[model samples]
Target: MTSLVKVLNENTIYNSEKLSNFIKYLEEKYIIKDEVIFFNQLVNFSQNNSIPLHGWFKYREGYSHTLVREMITRFTIDTKKEFIVDPFCGAGTTLVEAAVNNLDSMGVDVNPMSVAVTNAKTNSYSKADIEEVKLLIEEIPSIDLDQTEIIDYEDIQQYFSEDNFRALLAIKEFVNNISKPSVKELFFSGFLSIIEDSSDRKRDGNGLKKSLSKVTSVIDFYCDKMKLLMADISESSFCNIGKGYFGSATQLDKYVHEFSEEINKKPGLIVFSPPYANSFDYFESYKMELRMGDFIPRLGVKGLSDLRRLAIRSFVSAAKDPIEVDEIIDLMAIEIEEAIPLKETYTGKKDSRTRKVPQMIRGYFHDMGKVLEKCGKVLESGHKCCIVVDQSSYLGKIVPTDLFLAYLGEQVGFNVKEIIICRKAKTSGQQLQKYPYLAESLRESIVVLEKK
Candidate 1:
């Protein structure tokens, strides 16, 4: 498998056909493009950037509302789809949008911040509720952040100015005084919405960047957030139909059994966009928000270590053991390491944050395979699962993630219904810089599978 390949700015290195062979194997099930959908059908941040409550907080990898709506219409019969479960429901697009259309839905995620945001987004709000929040805003008092413990980490402190920190404290302290659970969650979400404005920490898709530029007041940002939130809520119906849980996606079926009423049937459609295998960790991205809410350390989700443990291997690995997956996947990972050699890929490169690309790649499909098995247990016969995902790559080795998941679905008693080409994904400049030999970007597709 060893063959000499030219590496940019580095010595001529050994490359393996492992990646090529892996893609070739996947070609057995990988359906070439049949047709193209509109740009809005693709899962992206742009489509969601201007949308109401959907735009509240940026879960950078979260898909747009139109994707969910389109999926719901296509899979359901006359809007009679009884249940939808999203194991990796970031921002609760599936659950929130489902409730808007008056459908039953459940959402799950390992990240506490994402779960809380989704829970608040899907919560039913009314005119009275909005008024209650506004009144609380006026009544709430600002506390001296010097005396209060809003954020305690030094790494996080690098992102906040003293004034920004104090202003954020006032808003969070206000949220703490609210007694209503629903209103509390809503206000807490509103508080989170303004974090980007309060801090110089600009959240790019893959990483956080520190900016020295001046930002707006926390109160002003929160006020703007509330106005848009109230507008979104005003048009939103109080369905009481959607529910979200703070749990791991790997155990989604367990949550289904524990939370479901006797009358609630198995899900008719299991639709979600799991985070890509790219090195984007939600827990790291929202550290400021999570620290403010006290959802980390001893209080929330688990600790930072445990959150990474529960999360799909999307980014850098901790000292934890590698997750067990299919032998083929493991072998491919081994071959990837042998072929490109992770260390060699970044010999002269400045950004060398990919020591564990093999594991993240293996761990992603590994956890997703388990997710499919768990989801398979709860889906009715003939029910469909629609997974929106983009292709994942490491070094020059691109993994056909959607196709691999489709094959894994077949192994767990589901037939590949079809793979729909949504749109060609926009390659990041970082990706281009990272893998110079790779010629093209991959496609983002919806892999449709049905229980046999």
Candidate 2:
């Protein structure tokens, strides 16, 4: 994929009328002159690495807990006024942050692994809980990786020495046997958190790639991680003990319907970063934990692809025929389709990426449209939906996701309230080829919309 992006680079931005018209439409329609605010660091997860309970599991796609907190404070919403909601609550960063601030929260995700991880982070735990987990760990009997029927990933064996792999398996088996659900989840989370060390995979911008492997002490690392998690739980100023559900964000009403009487009393303040139009499969990124921890029963490569298809259509794997639409989604699809031919006129032949990216863009907006419409059904009329999204450059054309989604929000009865420019990303060497024509830096946009 990296090589393909390089192939698409003509070093000269080809002029396309459709691209200009789309940008012009965005500027005129949604981006008001003084409303584009800048917040460089807050749009990312760097700060969350140091945060207490929120830092336990490293979900590559999550934004900062600080971003959620600041957005909440900016709204000046006390739980007394409204409960926080994060529909695409990857790893519960927003809900966990809300818990720290003594606010009520409700979060749900399409990914079960994500939901389980979120539940682990958001649930209350005591010193007794930590000690209980420690006792279970202490009770684990030594196992021979050579004899166990449980298998590690086919190629993952190369990343870990046999001894290290054996130790990890023993811990996984031990944690799996624990009878207590919440404590088991907490301990399992700590176990998953340290899985990356046993593999060469390191997170790189929404995806994981083979990187330098680290020398690790498997059992000791899990023990240390459990201690950190227990410490965070001990120190929490949990006010509402937010609940997390293992379900799709698009089914917000169904998830909340069980507690509708209580939920409807407070309007919802939602803050989440949905998957981007770029095709970075989360299942692929966390394969180490997914496979080794047995999150799914034998979810190999094919199973991972199947799961990807079920995710919001941000990645190519999730692409389906674009549904007929007359609004911003259709316009973006038209712009993408019209812009690609221009690349061919100047660059001899268009790269295949140019051909496929438009469909992905179309499908992404289509899925996002569903998500927004569902949010409208459940959110209170005056509350805001805060979203963090990055502009993606696909096939030598930049996709203005933030701007387009804001317009789409308006279509779903949302007021385009504020556009926060978190950061203007520095051009990648590959992206520089499309320069003079494409904007130099991609943007991380925080689009805030109020339900009308």
Top candidate by lDDT: 1
Error of 2 at 159 (Å): 4.8
TM-score of each: 0.86, 0.86
- lDDT, candidate 1, 174-284, per-residue tens: 788888898999888888877876888887765578776366566666776777776777777666567778888888888887656632555778899987877777777
lDDT of 2 by residue, 1-452 (tens): 12112322434322554545555566556643221343444444357878788788878778877777788888857556577778788888988888888887888876777787888888777667767866765654343345544354555666566767778877877787788888998888888888887666676755577775574667677777777877787777364757788767667777655444665546468788998777666776776676676766554567566567667877655565646654555555666677777768878885675577667777788778888887788777888898888877755566678888887888899999877766554445665664534453466768899999
Ten-residue region with minimum lDDT total, candidate 1: 1-10
TM-score of 1: 0.86
Q: What's the lDDT for candidate 2? A: 0.71
Clashes of 1: 0
Report how far off residue 438 is in candidate 2 (Å). Answer: 4.7
Each candidate: what lDDT? 0.72, 0.71
